[model samples]
Target chain A: MNFDNMRFSKEHEWVEFEKSSEVVTIGITDFAAGELGDIVFVELPEVGREVKNKEPVGAIEAVKTVADLFAPLSGVVKEVNTQLEDNPGLVNQSPYKEGWFLRLQMTDRSELDELMSHDDYSRITGTE
Target chain B: MSEPKKTPLYDVHQSLGGKMVEFAGFLMPVAYGSIIDEHNAVRERVGVFDVSHMGQFVVTGTDAREFVNRMITNDCSKLLPGNLQYTVMCREDGTVVDDLLVYVISEDRIILVVNAANIEKDYEHLTSRKRKNVEVSDVSEEYALVAVQGPRTREVIAACPFFGQVADRLQKLPYYNGITFYHRGAEVLVSRTGYTGELGFEVFVPAELAVALWDQIVVAGEDCGLAVIGLGARDTLRFEAAYCLYGHELDDHTSPLEAGLSWVVKLKKPSFCGAEALRKEKAKGSKRVLIGLAVSGRNIARQGYTVLRDGREVGRVTSGAFAPTLHKSLCMALVDRACSAGDGQFAVWVRDKEVPAKPTSLPFYKSRAK
Candidate 1:
């Protein structure tokens, strides 16, 4: 996955869109993963479930604390990452690739413009 | 509104990039890097912890022993010099005041180490009960404690220049015993006791010399893979070992019997604070008891979460975490005595769902001799 092409949410989630499909992949940013420490469990929204932007869809449990995983954009859940059931540490190891949370069938593709670009996200995370 | 207090090793923790957090009104390191790495380091090798945030009090006088015996639940009359005993202080109603370690320096002198958050309250309690011939003083500010624990602890201590001569003594020091030795014209008290279920030692030194002592031990244990641990791993380690933390497993409203600390309470003692209440509770049996719960899933159960049996709330989790050593999600909870009986199953409310769980024994982990 090209993180450069990803759009970011203020809640630290990122969405990547395909050129020929309305389906987009979502995951937490590397900075968010690092801050949360070791990831032990990831609760993903079920496929076919519709979610609204900024809504609480699932949860992530770390060794220290638990946090809510928010929906980055309104859409229908296409596919949930079943691999995370046995290997939640994948989020810590590869947040953008194998650790991608779920695929969403976009309701409105124009919402991508409201999300921050990679550079803007980096600036907000103080990584730039 | 006031700045949090700092330990003597504050600068050292910052230099090592420790993640600092406020605990018990003191700024302490939660972890230097990965808490799991630090936890594993202690299980496999040796690790040092700067636990200077814990409080200490010195009791000395002709009536020291007699006075102390009246304040705690443990039978300290059998405690000889150069020995340590784990005990709990209680209020008149038999609820816990604080759990502490009593180091018998001599017949007339003893040192009590208590939780940092309970320092002032414990001091006040001790002073208020002062008798004609006894003197109780809060010496917490004058001391710093460092714990070196794991299988390789003895080798690491022997490798140090200051402790080499006493290596054999340290190796021979039985568990729950201590000795005083001179280090650079200062008296350092070393004890064979630790919270982790490992062969370990705790050293008490003058606060001013804490930095030097920490640095030397770090260098000596470098070859043994001794990592500096923090409070994050400390809680996990102790929880796995089934050690009761003051605020979590114990509180003013919790009794020692309910906390599974009956071994430390002595009913045969002639007279002690809360003796009558504890005796009555012992005869009547406690209404609630502490029990271990092992969750069946990866979702961890945290403190304050409710435990249920047949869809009814039975208890609340006091301490819970993913056990790094056991590779299981476990917790200690205080529940209705009836729910903890027989072969009943439990479920812990994690987030919006109730995850299945079952009662288990205390101490999810134990160290195997090498």
Candidate 2:
């Protein structure tokens, strides 16, 4: 639940660095999953698919509704969460942990600076 | 945000942390906890739904049956007191306006419950075509409707100290039967029919007493596992049960025959709203039929998903969802006449994704249902 080291978006996405220099992990914000009930399916982008910042790279569907997962930064999709196809409720149970949507091959790592910080995203979503 | 409209049971759902949604202009609880949890509660034990948004109208006086027989497609002349039947209000062209339940409470009085979105429209239609001997009026705002559905509904009612009689009526009553009965001294009309594909009852009571009734029922049934359901679970439960939703399956553009509900229509009648039209359509078989499609891929075929044959668009997906009961991608699609696509020979173009699907029979999870 702590978003201290992350950068967030108004669309309810978060990006964080994976210990390695070029790797980035992406997931939908808690607000998105809560607004959408139990997640039923997630369509992740193919590996090596280049995506622009804020452009949709994948989708998430819940029992009653559906939402788009946007690319937090312009990057090539290094990995997509395949496990979500069978158990999409992971987003509802643990959207931040096991529910991470995709991993990106970051093109411009500095784009993270433009995203809202933890405190800023919390205020924007009004979940503060 | 604008002020969220509240139902008669608004406080009860919110107090239990319900997620609210605007459906047919009313702020209604779509779910209390998890949708699947609430859905399963209805199938296994009992679940209560605040269906006040659905409109109710009263038709009374000397010629109630005559008025209904002329307006709706079903024959009402044979309906005596304490009888109920599922009927459809249709346009002159035989296209369904809205499917509803007609309750003949007495020789001179009857109550008609309609879909929430078609309240104003159905009311206006009834009033404009007023019968000389029958007085028709919309009494939706003055009433609140509640539904207690599932197999163990009777057990839950017995827990209510004042509901001994209600429990008995619900158990002995046959399907499609209704009675203007009493509940804890307050008179109500309980009908033995529901959308959940189970033994259930729909209660119509005074709007002012709605909240008290919901709380009383909840407290009485809590130990028996009666959950408070919202629209979210309602849609899923109905879909899993293969029940047709008005907007999705049957619309102004879709005919009753095409929607596979012609059983409710009586063409034997001398004359009703759409008898002639339906008779002609019957001679010339319907162009399309509503069939169930269970998909294989994760890309769900939603409301407007295109159905493809030979990779070309054939028909459209009317309503689709992640069916909780079957735990698979399921949809209801209207395809070309007598779609010959064998068991596993169909696909849906879901947002540029060609997802694998097959034409499966409805009620995807019949074995587990109540």
Candidate 3:
């Protein structure tokens, strides 16, 4: 829940880097989940698929609408949350923890600098 | 084009954290929290929906019944007072104008409940087709409507203190029937009908008393698991029941017979608005038929998605959703009659990808109301 270490995207995604590794975990923010209503299914990208920053690599299917999951940073998909295959509600229930979408090996760590902090994201979404 | 109108329950929805959206010229709630939760609550227990945005019109005069019978596709002559009929009004060419519920009150009075988006158009259609001895009045602003649905719907209503003696009679009120009583000197009508495939009631109360009525129902259903639903859940519930949404399934270009609403289109009726055109179409046979499609993919086959038979496009999806109750991706589409005959290899174009689909029978979910 600490925003000090998290980087948020204008598209409502959040990214957290590992302590010393180039790998960064990605997921949509709670505000995004709330906006999408009840998530029923999620389409995950295959591991090792190279993704570009701001490019859609996967999709999240809610009860009424579908949203593209955009990559917050350029990287190769290293791991995906397989648990979301059967229980997509986790994205709404725990947007920052277990609902994490995928971990990517960062191609450009500097991309995180361009992302917004929790404060900036809160302001953009008017969640504060 | 102008500022969206707000219903009497607008403030109540805001306080409940409802996600408001502009729909049919009114600012209404799309969901309070989760649509699936609201949908399940209606299927398993009870749920309430604020549908005040829907339009209501009253027809009165000596020739009201006869005028109504000539306007709608259904035989209103068979309906007794206090009966309700799901019917459609069409143009002279057999194209749909709007599908509405006809509330037959008496030989000289009737009520027409129409969809919100089509209020102005329906009013114009009715007035243009108006006959002698009949008068049409738009009373939409005078009433606020709420739908309470589920297996436990009756229990929730019976517990409401304001209902008084009417509660006892409502229990015996058969399906498609309604009862009217005076509440605070204002006429209130409660009908045993709903869009969801469950035992439900649609209450038309005075606009001024709408907030109080909604509050009372919420309090009464506190112990029995009642969720305050919004438009999101309302669509899914009705889609599960295969109810034809006005814009989705029924439109100005589609005939009632092709929409699989032949049962309600009484061609035997001597003369109605579209009776002649419908009779001819029925004899010639409809070229298109509405069919259900079960998508075998994670992605939803959304509206306007192309339906494919082999490699050729056959039809377009009308309405689709990940059915919360069924837990499957399903959609309803109007396809060529040849493609509707038997279950065959079908697919839906979800963007550029072709997802496998199967031609299934209409109504992916069965009705539990009866």
Give Cα-based local distance difference scores for all models. Answer: 0.91, 0.82, 0.91
B1-370, model 1: which lDDT tens digit per residue? 4688999999999999998999998899998988888889999999999999999999999999999999999999989999999999998899999999999999999999999999999998888987899999888889999999989998899988767668789878999999998888888999999898888999999998899989999999999999999998888889999999998999999999999999999989998988999999999999899989999888789999999987789999999998989888999999999766776669999989989998888878878741
lDDT of 3 by residue, B25-124 (tens): 9999999988888999999999999999999999999999898899999999879999999999999999999999999887789999999999999999
Where model 3 places Cα greater than 4 Å from the true spot, the runs are B339-343
- Best-fitting candidate, measured by TM-score? 3
TM-scores for every predicted model = 0.96, 0.94, 0.98
TM-score of 3: 0.98
Query: Residue A104 CA error for candidate 3 (Å)?
Result: 0.6
TM-score, cand. 2 vs. native: 0.94
In terms of docking quality, model 3 is: high
Residue pairs with backbone overlap in model 3: none
Per-candidate DockQ values are: 0.74, 0.72, 0.82
* Candidate 2: tens digits of C-alpha lDDT, residues B74-187: 888898888898888888898988989899999888999899888878988888887588898888888888998887777766776545665776668777888776665667
How does chain A of every candidate compare to the true chain A by TM-score? Answer: 0.96, 0.92, 0.97
Q: Candidate 1 at residue B238, lDDT?
A: 92
